[model samples]
Target: MLFRLALAMGRTLQELRATLTYAEFQEWCLYYQIEPWGEDRADLRAGIVASTIANYAGKLRAEGSDPALPADFMPYLERPEPADPSDDRHLTDDELAAWADAAIFGIPPE
Candidate 1:
């Protein structure tokens, strides 16, 4: 997946790895219609849902009708705040373990 992303972005894998933060990588994945491996399922699902709605809106506009989507209808279009890498606070071992279990086992972590 990383190789494909690198090719699509016209960047070498080393450069992509060196330059992109995780969030930026995800944004690029979405732009290139490539799914990021190991992305949270809920986030992927939300993207799918939003894409569907946007497509439907496009169809309606093509038919000479206004869908009148709300200003905030597509929240995914907004850029999220960049993560602060220098912050010392981070997820605990237990929280990381729980997230891994949730991703692998399809169970929500408590």
Candidate 2:
């Protein structure tokens, strides 16, 4: 749901990149009541942050600057797999977003 919400927010993938600090993002997630909070959630945020850092690093490299990812960040380079579109049970974007919003804000879709 976070993935879908982020994608819906903007065009560039960088926009979805975890720009906030882990602590800040975690707080936001908690406020939204994102589920399964613990190391798994922490790891998700970390991956987002690391991916953003890597994106910038790549851009910098292209611009003739040297950048390197730390060992911890390296492991997170591979992103989590998106849901398979062929799955019969997967909700459409509108449905998913509506559900997510209702879950987070207690406001159902019109």
Candidate 3:
């Protein structure tokens, strides 16, 4: 059932990005062999949306640098308060689009 449920879920960055927290995102990333960030802080500073996590994942894929998010992203992910943490960390509507401009699509950060 669990496997089926997981299978039922769409296999795309957009799909997985819908329901993820910082902790969950980190765990998922580890499973996919994408480190994108520290385990504890993976999603900690990322946004709770597909675009944010997906952006970083996209960047990693493009860089051909698996096992880690852009080591550069942690700062944004850890931005100070009133900052929507995710928004502060990931910084949507900016370089992310450029970072994720991959040639081909892949599964979510896992």
Candidate 4:
């Protein structure tokens, strides 16, 4: 899911994972109307919203008006520094794998 989002947003996976805070990532997903967990028919809803946006853009272009995107359409390029710089340490491989499992599979970290 993150891979697909990265492609759609023209951002690198590392950027998504390391740069954005969890809250920012959630906001980005909400902007795209994609539910990261694929729950509650969210995928279908996102598709409908995307189709609607595309059709609207096409209509605008047909009328000789270029549609402008919202100013806050994209996620922030950088997150603010943590209060404690030491809190910015990189995750270990095992920790990363655990987080991936939790995010992708809904398996709570042990």
Highest lDDT among the candidates is held by which one? Answer: 1
lDDT of 4 by residue, 1-110 (tens): 57666877688999878887888867775654444433323544555666568767677466765553432132321233547766777889999998777655445678
lDDT of 2 by residue, 1-110 (tens): 35534544553445655464567656656754745444345666776688678867688466765454343454433343667878779678999898777656546677
Q: Per-prediction count of colliding residue pairs?
A: 0, 0, 10, 0
The TM-score between candidate 3 and the true structure equals 0.19
Pairs that collide in candidate 3 are 22-43, 28-110, 29-110, 35-67, 35-68, 36-68, 36-69, 45-77, 76-89, 77-89
The CA lDDT of each predicted structure is: 0.63, 0.59, 0.44, 0.60
Task: Answer with 3 or 4, whichever has the higher TM-score.
Answer: 4
C-alpha TM-score for every candidate: 0.28, 0.27, 0.19, 0.28
Report the C-alpha lDDT of model 1 over 13-75, residue by residue, as the tens digit. 999899989998677656544334433434566666776688676775667655534332434
Model 3 segments beyond 4 Å from truth? Answer: 1-8, 11-15, 34-110
Instruction: Report how far off residue 106 is in candidate 1 (Å).
Output: 19
CA-only RMSD, every prediction: 14.3, 15.9, 17.0, 17.3
What is candidate 3's CA lDDT for residue 95? 49
* Model 3 error, position 39 (Å): 25
Model 3 lDDT tens row, 1-108: 122224445455555556656687555545544433233345445533444666666774756544444433544443324555455465466445543442112212
TM-score of 4: 0.28
Local error of candidate 3 at residue 6 (angstroms): 10
